[model samples]
Target: MDGGNNGGRINVAIDGPAGAGKSTVARRVAEQLGYIYIDTGAMYRAVALAANRAGVLPSDADRLAELVKTVDITLEPGADGQIVRLGGENITTDIRSREVTLKVSEIASHEAVRLRLVEMQRKLAEAKGVVMDGRDIGTHVLPGAEVKVFLVASVQVRALRRYQELSEGELVPLEQLEQEIADRDRSDESREFSPLVRAKDAEVLDSTELTIDQVVAHILDLCRTKTAEAK
Candidate 1:
């Protein structure tokens, strides 16, 4: 694993829009590389969860800022994937709920949340053996990362993937899910701070027709190439 990477390892940054399978792909890639997986979106989702439970509106920046400071959000590896903890509670499943998903963008749009979480994310990547996935990671969080992959898929494709992940009781119409994902894409891209633009040097991967294993394999190949170049 230490083959040609600088300082014995490399940082892999993955950025993408909603429901693009970024979290799954990044987690798998991190597992294969023996790297820590940092789900930056989950951090925001944790904030959204905290906000939701606290009755704090996303528009209330000062309140949100105070709320973030008082909460503790952490990501740790689990048997299945990354586990998220908020205030010492296992919120891995909670953060992925549709409510948190819908509010995450709004919470993340606040400069207070982004500034604080981005600092934490940057600190996590400083160790060099981390795979981070989020909208602004490659563009802002880790611009000099050794490897950057921007994953993308059609909105319908992404929405279907998300739909399959949700349990039956939480099901929404596929058409509605598609529209939600599309709206999120526009919101993410048009956000004033750290919008979801692919980094200039990042490799763009369209995984609309690719399996999870196929996408992981392709990213591993890129990791090898970048690590070799780092030598």
Candidate 2:
């Protein structure tokens, strides 16, 4: 499907399960296209980190929703990568910690939380020319996005990739990482609100046998083709 141009800003939505390299590929694609890279997952992770710091359980939906309103989450483009700020503090690395990774899905599953965050996400992409990646970006956050790509890889491959990415500081067992990824997949797919599902119009790309550059190139090609068709 061709993504229609909106005020010359092309909106790209990429969705996938955990460890599918959505964030990395999305960043590179955005850089290549010179578009804003919005990591919706990281936004949720920021919230989870705050909730954890505040002693709010993931099951406390009401409190979590209130907490979301109180905190300010911002994403900035940095020389190295996107920097995530929560309430004016830099928690870019904190949100990626194991604790946040374990509870982000639960916090994100809250209906109220999703509503609030989705509103913010839509606002950020209102002008388009953005590449957003998340479990529901194509399915929910940006249903009208001109270019949508659903990236996927085998669980084992994704686990290995994640392990390698995190192996520099911590020594997590490969088997444990695999199970965590599987668990996250189940949680994200089984959630009652905005469960992870591929958008019908999104092109499914399997990255199990593909390199990062290859995936980025494929998506860039899609963007070029769709943009040209739109023009």
Candidate 2 per-residue lDDT over residues 1-231, each given as its tens digit: 323435456899999999999999999999999999999999999989999999999999889989988779999999889999987898888998877888998899999889889999999998789999999999999999989999999999999988888846678999999999999999999999999999999999999999999999999999988788776
Clashing pairs in 2: 3-146
Q: C-alpha displacement of 205 in model 2, angstroms?
A: 0.2
Error of 1 at 194 (Å): 0.7
TM-score of each: 0.96, 0.95
Query: C-alpha displacement of 120 in model 1, angstroms?
Result: 0.5
Off by over 4 Å in 1: 1-7
